[model samples]
Target: MKKLLLAGVTIAMMATPAIAQTYKFAVVPKAMNNPFFDVARDGCLKRAKELGNVECIYKGPIEHEPATQAQIIQDFITQKVDGLAISVADVASMTKSIEAATAAGIPVITFDADAPGSKRIAYIGTNNKDFGLALGKQLLQLRPEGGKYAMVSGGPGAKNLAERVDGVREALKGSKWVEVQGSPTFCNDDSTLAVQQMSDLRTATPDLAAIVPVGGWPMFAPEGFKAFVNKNKKDIDSGKLTLVVADTLKMQLELLRDGYSNALTGQRPFEMGEKSMDTLLAIKKGQKVPEVIYTGLDLVTKDNVAQLLK
Candidate 1:
């Protein structure tokens, strides 16, 4: 009887399940102000829930400040999170923090914006150069007759936006359809400032045939969004102006619907957020991931806008 009791106890102990390991992944965006990052956060949260035992902590500075972003990274490092994914606001400033995270045995990855020189394992976001080329192509399709254009962009120092602008110039090389009007008007990722800049551009170049905003700042605000479309409504209707920008969020899609915009190049920000976390988890598990993961882009026009909306 004693032997049988001991055997039953051993069986019970052997049948017990092991506790699941929990991973904490921190997702730091360039700024928390933009709706784009909000969508990205949603993706991260959804994926985190789907991937049980993994917690995704999405955070960033309210403004586009490199120092602020760096501090956040540092805090996360101190907290000893399992891994980190960042969309660096400033490449130069954030490199040190990224290196520090890696030095401490934490894996880091970038999305939306990248710090390519850092020790990050992978970059997951749109190919900015190709994105610009696609924008150039859309411009050509909109108006084949050469005309003037301007770029409303984010920070001048942002490497990704600069790359897109360079690609735009390359695509327009020797082209008769359009010519760059002036230096890029930096919006600084402020929605109000974006509207003001657009208004100023319209005033300075009433003949502005095409406007390409590398990042969709104004469209994040109801007022800014309405103002950009309403102000350009006449020109768009008369075929005198062509507005094209990066990002295809629902509001931008509406602009495409209302004829206020000629074309909108969309980024897979949701996938960026989702994959960033997943990649970090894989890295934590000692699984190898790619150095660069391209999320892909989509061109939304009047034709297929409905499909996307539905």
Candidate 2:
């Protein structure tokens, strides 16, 4: 009996730390193949290593959609994840699943995009309004004489992109010369596809003064928009089309420097991952985190582009 009790105690001791072992967190983006979210995933993984024993799982659909994100969010809940995050592709479509995750007691942080009314605890991404306002301010600087400019973006239903697109329009409102003429084209987060779409739009509009690709991915670099520019470099050079990208993607900086992008609006990818882990660890440690943590953004221009780019 004495030996058995000692054996039982030993087993308990072994089980304690195992039970206390760090749990899994999930990072779900709009799509599994997107290079943009992969950067954020890269940051999350890098930071996950520093935390030791904590695991960060990344999953998403083939295409960027709210339903797929919701499904991934539900899977996290079913798997009993410690935390979950999403760069919402569609806001309204994700509401129920986000609520489901909340019901399961797993806190969720929205990245890249957000659902303002959802049960999500916080967002760890660019400030959309600031992104918009900054773009507005930048547009005036770029074309002080303000002429007809068109906007290209992702889905019209996308919350974050819409904010930036709207902000650009608002900024150009005061400039009588800067008319936003062309119909807004969708970027869909695929550089190749975006290029093709932009090319078609450019072909249709005879006087598309400037192209504003709001946010990361398509607008960030011309190579990403090559479907249009690759065939018409002369047009881009002749001043018929000037491309304005949203955020600076690290790997795409070379393309930007090579003249594919006029400038890029940059977001803090590494810090986003680090901050996200910090938030989860804080919650695990019985600490309270804020409902909103606004990770700001910056603009990258030809002048100081090499500073961070290199």
Candidate 3:
């Protein structure tokens, strides 16, 4: 993320308006306020300034919602922005708005999350399925027998979450465990939601050996599942429950250190933001660009966290 964000700072400086560039750009993330994209947003701003005439803006729903994000995209179209960078909140619902953006002669390139059916020029992000596969492999390594594991997905049907979970399913197909139960929880980027979901999932499945949350809200929520644990400290302290997940929150990394979480699937959000800016610049200057650029993925665990955190 540092490298990518720094690259944006440099690019924004070098790609000044004197270079025949004037653009109004916008990026929509899953939500408006998360440290993950807070870093990315900083990069976007730096690039916008360095490009001189370039004006960049970012808008996202207070929580992760496709309808709100789609509205933001339409608003960008009405404003006639040169380019739209969307990190889709819901893949299916955002398709039409994306189509409209292109129809208005505005190019769209999606980052972290995606609207696959839309006519975006390119997608700059990780191969989410591969990320899920990596998560499953790590879980297996931790518990080779692969006992019944439960998932607390951030949202019921979010595309990126679904993809990572699908990858986990594919990897676990031959393993010796049937999914006893799981629920799609919504933290809505709020700690209260975490409290609610934790209470709900504990009520839903009491016997899950491991609980995995592939979504950031649940995996990183400050008080996630703690309510249930507070009531059942004996259950948790007795080592009856285990956990696994993918995310980049520093607290989650700490949990990894304490053995509460086995691993994390990291998406280079800063890289995505920086590279997306680079992609837009290439297109503006009439340079060829790849239709899809993989930003890459990382698996961070207790054993490797020291190196990864460094």
Candidate 4:
């Protein structure tokens, strides 16, 4: 009887499935202060909980500093994380760190912003050039007989923003719209500086017909952006000046409804975060994955802002 009982216990143990290995996936965003990235962080955490074996470590510089961001990546590599997903702050700087991680036998992927020259396994984010084209087209639709416009971008070294700028230019090619001299002022991800630059650009070029921000930097600061919009209310209402900014955050949507912006082009940062983990897990399991995974974009205007809010 004792021998039969022992045999039954051994069979039961053998039939039970072994626990899966837990993966520690780190998601490095451009900055921790940006509310836009907060959504991404939520997505990462949600997906990690769903997976039950993925530990998502979301960390980055307090602000948009390439050097600081690179240091964070180095620290993660030293910690020997199972996989890494980064939104590249500076393409060149991030590429070096990504290559080092790959050499260390760790899988690496990029999201939000990409470093195409790097040895990273895959990129999961928006096709920024297309995002820019959409921004330009939105502006054109608002003020089709374009006059003068200036672009506002986050970081000067950001590959994503540069592509969007180029795309906007491409979309405006042969159109009446002309980019103002000394346009595309870089705010370096500072919301205050972004609003100031907008004011300064408008002051410098009185005939500036449109202001296109490839990213919604100023919109992050609701009161300040509201004040700026209120100051420019006459122009915006008269259609003499148009504002087409990127991202459809809650605050941005509110501003759009309040007539602060003409149009908005949004990226799915949350989806980027969720998919970053999914892609990294597949790579860790040696499964096939695509080189580029575009999360898609949202073009928001007064027409859809109400429904999106709900």
Candidate 5:
């Protein structure tokens, strides 16, 4: 009887399955304070929960600072995270850090903004140039006659925003629209500065025909943007000034409905966050993944703003 009991215990031990290994992935955004990245953080956490044995560590600088972001990546490396996903603030700096992380046997990927030169396994975000083209096309549709325009952007070093700006320029090629001198005033991810820049640009170029913000920096501060629009209501209503910004955040959509903006081109940060984890997991398993995974874009205008809000 003792032998039979021992034999049964051994069989039970053999039948039990082994516990799966838990993967710790760190999702680093450009700025933790930005609402856009907040959505991405939510997605990362949601996917991590759904994929049991996966832990998502989301961390980044409070503001958009390349040096600070680089330091954060270094810290993650020291912590020996299993994988890394970054929304690069500066391509050059992030490339070096990503290479270091890869050399340490950790897989790395980029999302939202990419550092193509880096050793990252894949890029999961929008086709920024295409996004820019869409913005340009939208502006053209709004003001076909063409006029002097300026672009507002966050962090001048951001590759994604630069691509969008280039795309806007490419689409406006041969059109009546001309970019204003010293255009694309950089806000460095400061919403308040973004509003001030826009106001200043308008003041400097009194006849500035249109304004395109590759990212919705100003609209992040709803009240400030509203004030800016109200101050310029005369020009906006008379069709003397046109506003075409990026991102379809709730407040931005509201501003669009209120006639503060003419058009909006948005990106899917949530999807970017979710896919960043999926791609990193595949990399860890030695599975093949695309070099570029475009999450896609959303073109919002007066006609469809209502539907999107719903």
Candidate 6:
């Protein structure tokens, strides 16, 4: 009888689960190949290290396929990660997956690009409309007497890009000199595609005044930048075309110095990662986090571009 009782007690103790001390959080991006996302991952990992009791998992789709992002989120769900920070590629397609994550009792927050209608706890990135408004403001400074300008962007249906385009139009509303040439061209986040579109547009409208890319997709490919410089150098030199782009990554600063682009808009991607982790952790702890969080932006120009280079 004594031996039987002791064996039963030992079995019960062994079956009891140990207390969980470390947490795992997953950070999902629009695409894994972009260097911009790598910066954001650095921020997320830095925050995870600072917390000392958390692990950050970074993953994303290889391309911008509609199902890839949603599928990755579902995989994270299956892994049962403690929290998720995502930059959704498509809002409508992702809503159900985001809601499913929420329903699974996992905390979800969005960074960079937000799915506003989803159940995401908070948004941590630039206010994209304001981002566009600022870009338009800089364009005016470059060409206050603008003749005709064109915009290059990621996806036409992308929420963030659309907002920025709208802001650009709004900013140029009262100005008679500036005219947005046509509907913003969508490059689908392909730098090569962006280069082709810009080349085609310039060919069609030889007197195209300015080329403003809502995102610096094309500049990511050195060949694309080289093509732009080679093809448009004369126009740029003659002040017939001004190139202003968003996202002042290191490559962009180099482009500014080499006179390939006129200006760049910088976003705090590091902060996007750090704050996103902090917000997701807070939500998991049943603490309150604001519904919207706006990271800072910087306008990089030749006059002050040297500061960012360092």
RMSD to the hidden true structure, all candidates: 2.5, 4.4, 9.5, 2.4, 2.4, 5.0
lDDT of 2: 0.73
- lDDT tens string, model 2, 1-310? 1223564563323333345568688888887666777778888898889889678888888776666667777767888999887778888877777888888888777877888899887788888867876776676776676666777787667898988877777777778446444557776766666666666667777676677777555643444455456666786777566677777777656666777756667777667776787787777777888877877787877787788775
lDDT of candidate 4 over 1-310, digit per residue (tens): 1222564563323355788999999999998988999999999999999999999999999999999999999999999999999999999999999999999888999999999999988999899999999999998888888899999999988999999999999999999999998889999888888999999999999888999988989999888898898999998899999999999988899899888998999999999989988998998888999999999999999999998889
Better of 2 and 3 by lDDT: 2
Count of clashing residue pairs in every prediction: 1, 6, 2, 0, 0, 0
Worst 10 residues of 5 by lDDT: 1-10
Candidate 6 least-lDDT 10 residues? 1-10
Candidate 3 lDDT, 1-310, residue by residue in tens = 1223464563223333444557778888878755667767777887777766777787888776768877888888999988888887777777888889889988889887766777888888878888778777777776776666766565544677778878887877889745664444555555456556656676677766666666555544555544445566665566566556776666667666665555787777777877777787777777888988888877887788876655
For model 1, state the Cα shift of residue 152 in Å. Answer: 0.9
Question: Which segments of candidate 4 are over 4 A away from where they belong?
Answer: 1-16
TM-score of 4: 0.95
Better of 3 and 6 by lDDT: 6
CA lDDT, every model vs. true structure = 0.84, 0.73, 0.71, 0.92, 0.92, 0.85
Error of 3 at 8 (Å): 52
Residue-wise lDDT of candidate 6 within 1-310, one digit each (tens)? 1222564563323454766577899999888877788889999999999997889999998766658888999999999999999887888877888899999988899899988988988899999999999998898898888778888888655798889998888877787545555648988788788888888878888888888888888788867777877888998988889888899888888988888888898898999999988888888778999999999899999999999999
Question: What is candidate 5's CA lDDT for residue 64?
Answer: 92
Descending-lDDT candidate ranking: 5, 4, 6, 1, 2, 3
For each candidate, what TM-score against the reference?
0.94, 0.87, 0.84, 0.95, 0.95, 0.91
lDDT of 5 by residue, 1-310 (tens): 1222564563323445788988999999999878999989899999999998899999999999999999999999999999999999998999999999999999999999999978998999999999999999999999999999999988878899999999999999999999999889999888999999999999999999999988988999889999999999999999999999999988889899988899999999889889988888888888999999999999999999999999
Clashing pairs in 5: none
Using lDDT as the yardstick, the better of models 3 and 4 is: 4
Score candidate 3 by TM-score against the native: 0.84
